[model samples]
Each structure stands twice: as structure tokens, then as C-alpha cells.
Target: MALRPNPTLRQRRLGSELRRMREQAGLGGSELARRLGIGPAQMTQMEQARIGVSPERLRMVASACGCSNEPLIDALARMTSERGKGWWEEYRGVLTVDFLEVAELEAHAERITFCTTAYIPGLLQTPAYASAVFARLFPPLPPREIETRTEFRIRRQELIRSGGTPLHTFIHEAALRMQFGGPSVLLDQLRALLDDSERPGISVRIVPFAVDTFPGAGENLTFANGPVAELDTVEVDVSQGALFLESPTDLANHRAIFSRLDATALAEKESRDFIRSIMKEVESSNA
Candidate 1:
């Protein structure tokens, strides 16, 4: 098959897993390629995610590399076996790869946990709220681009809404009060938050300003739990854009940081009360 000029994050992730397994087994790409009866370049291409690997080839490579973790292998195989294009394909030309990656990751993730400080988690945002945030783009997106992106955000929410994957989000109190679009928009957003919180498969927790400390406060993070710990991925939102981290060390660090955040944040019940009080605060101010 011809190589994809641009590989999605999931594809790149599969390649990373293969590379890790090969390294763990202390086998070089050339040696492995020889064992598998393929060209060295073909092995490199698969590992670089420039080319897709068939499910049969995936198992062959895993077995050849002596990758013993059955769960990881199965998960990787499943990723490869996923046929047909996903909904994100429709936005291929309109949005950058990173934006599409977020949707793809969320779509397949077993579970999603987001710690958002500056803004509401995208999945939980209302159309008006999301549109307002997009409209404020500094460089200013073309009108059509803004509309497209906002629509994409709304559609992405369907992953969780469909009850296919569970989502737990930790949000700071500041975000609940930001009033991104103005009082009317903010009011509706807070109500939407309350509504989403009540939905099955969705959990929302708040970290009050009164809390003594907030760890990993500056960096926005979402841990998209895969089928197993080995396949787990962490996303860090930076100024340049989203950064995907899957190395053992990066995963461990992010896991610990989120554990702490989850521990310090309000309990789900208290979080509801906190959100309600904040709603009242906003109401009084607007009055």
C-alpha cells in the first residue's frame, strides 16, 4: 500500500508501540525485517507510520519481536483492523491534523479524563460557548473556518453522549466563572454543565479557588486510557498545540499529577453544590 503523506496520531502511536517492542527485544529494524521476510525500508515505513500495517502483519511483527503482552498486541491489532474512514475524515481539509487527532482519540478511547483550567472541557461545551471562544481567535479565523471548527467541536461531543465511552473531567472554579461569551452565554453554559454532569457515563468535578494548591495548574491535560496501561496516551495542550505523550516515564508522571488533582478536587456531590453556588454568584453579579 502507498504510504500516507500524513499519518494520524493513532497510526503514529501504533508505530511507536512497534518501535518500543523491537527495542525491548534488542533487535534492530534490519534484523527484524530479515526475519519477517520484508525489506528494511518496509519495516522502517511501518514503524514510522508512513504506511499502514495489516492485522496479519501486525501479529507477525509482534510475534517476531517476541512481544508477550497479549492485551497490548490485541489492542494494536484492533487499531489496525479498524476499516473505513471515521467521521473526522470529513474535516480533513478544513482542520489541521492535530484537531482531527483529538476527535479520533476521543472516539476510540476506552475512557477519557480531562483536567482543564482555562476553559470548559471541549466535550462539555455548549455551541454558543464554543462559538464565542472560537470567534475570539487572535489572528482571526475566516468566518467559514470558525463555523466549521465550532461544528466539529459540537460533533465531537457525541462520542461521550452516545454512552460509548465514559468521561471524567476535573475543572477549576475559574473556568466556571470566565463568562467567555457574556452573561447570557455563561448562564446557559453553567446550566449545561449541570445538565451534562447528571448524564450517565459523565462525571464532572470542580476545584474551588479556596483550595490550597493546584498541581499541574498551568498545563492542560487529558489522559485517554486505551485498552491497557501499555497503550495509554496523555495529551498536553501547549501554546504550539497538542502534544501526545506515551512513553513510560511521561505516562507515569501525568498519571500521578492527575491522581493528585482528582484527590484534591471537590467530591462529585460537593462539586455539584459548588457549581450551583457559582451560578448564583454569576446571577447576582449580572443583576
Candidate 2:
């Protein structure tokens, strides 16, 4: 097969995990290639995600690496077996890769947790608010680009609306009051948030300004729980774009940060009340 020019994050992660398995078994690429009856370069391509790995090949590699963790090996095999194209692929060339990868990550996530300080989480954003947020980009995007991004974002929210995956989001009071599109837009957004908070599989909590301490240094992050803990991933929103984190250390740290934010935020019922209060304020201000 021809080598992939730009492998998706999931593809790269599979390669990384394969490499990790080899390293843990203290085997060099050449040695593994010899054992697997393939050329060293072929092994390198597989490990680099430039080429695909069949389930049989993946199991063979796991056996060679002395990896007895059946659950992990099964998960890897499933990853290798996935052949369906995701909905995000439709926007592949039109939007940035980060957007597509983020959607992919959420689609595969068994559970998702989001923490934000300044802006509403994408999975919970209204179309008007998302369009407004995109409109204010530093290097302003063209009108067409803004519309595309807003549409993509609204599409992403389908994962939440499906209620198949559990979602827990922590938003700071500051984000609730940002008025991205305008007071009217933010009001609609907040009301939508309130409605979503009551959903069976969704949890929305607010971190009030009255809180004595806040964590995560005010960063916006999404932690996606994988089928297995080792497969978990985190996406941090930065000025450049979405940064995906998967190393054991990065996963642990972000998980801890989410825990801290969870503890600091108000309970679900209280958060709903808080949002209602904010809606009233927005209405009064507009009046």
C-alpha cells in the first residue's frame, strides 16, 4: 500500500502504541521485522502510521512483543480493523485537520469532559454564538471560512444530542457572561445550556467567580475517555489550534486537572439555577 502522507491522530496513535509495545519488549525494529518476516523499512512504516496494520499482523506483533494484556491487544486490533470513514471526512480539505481530529476523538470517546474558562465548550455551543466567536479571530477569517467553521461546530454537537456518549462539562461564570454574539445570542445559548444540562447523559456545571481558587491556569480542555484507560486522549485549545495529548503522563495530569475543576464547580442543579439567574440578568439588561 502507498504510504499515507498525513495520517490522522488515531492512525499515528496506533503506530505509537505498536512502537511502545516493541520498546517495552526490548526489541529493535530490525529484530521485530526479522521475526515478523518483513523488511525493516516495512516495519518502520507500520510503526510510523504511514502504512496500515491488519488485525492478524497486529496480533502477531503483540504476541512477539510478549504483551499479555488481552484487553489492550483487543482494543488495538479493533483500531486496526476500523475501516469506515467518519462524517468529519466530508470537511477534510475544507477545514483544518485539527477540527476533523477533534470530531473523530469525540465520536470514539465513551465519555467526554470539558473545562473552559473564557469560552463555551464547542459541544455545548449554539450556532449564533459559535459564528460570533469565529468572527473575532485575530487574523480574521473570510466570511465563507467563518460560516464553514460554524457549520462544522454545529455538526459536532450532534454527538451530544445523540445522548449515546456521556458528557460532563465545567464552564466558568466568566464564559457564561461573555456575550459572544450579543446579549440576545448569549441568552439563547444559556437557555440552551440549561436545557442540555437536564439531558440524561449530559452534565453541565458552573465555576462561579466567588470560588476562592481555580485550577488548570484558565486553559480550555477536553478529556475523552477511551474504551481502555491507556487509550484515553486530551485536547487542549491553544492559540494555534487544538493540541492532542496521549502520553501516559499527559493523560494523568489532565485527568487530575479535570477532577480539580469538577470539585470546584457547582452541582448540576445549582448550575442550572445559576444559568437561569444569568438569563434573567441578560433579559433585564436588554430591557
- Native-to-model Cα distance after best TM-score fit, residue 226 in candidate 2, in Å: 0.8
Winning candidate number (lDDT)? 2
TM-score of each: 0.96, 0.97
C-alpha RMSD of each candidate structure in angstroms: 1.2, 1.2
Model 1, 168-282: lDDT tens per residue? 9999988888888898899899899999999999999999899899988887799999999988889989878789899999999999999999889999889999989988988
Residue-by-residue lDDT tens digits, candidate 2, 163-253: 8999999999999999898998898899889888999999999999999988875689889999999999999998888999998999988
Which segments of candidate 1 are over 4 A away from where they belong? Answer: none
Candidate 2 C-alpha error for residue 255, in Å: 1.3
Q: What number of clashing residue pairs does each candidate have, in the order they appear?
A: 0, 0
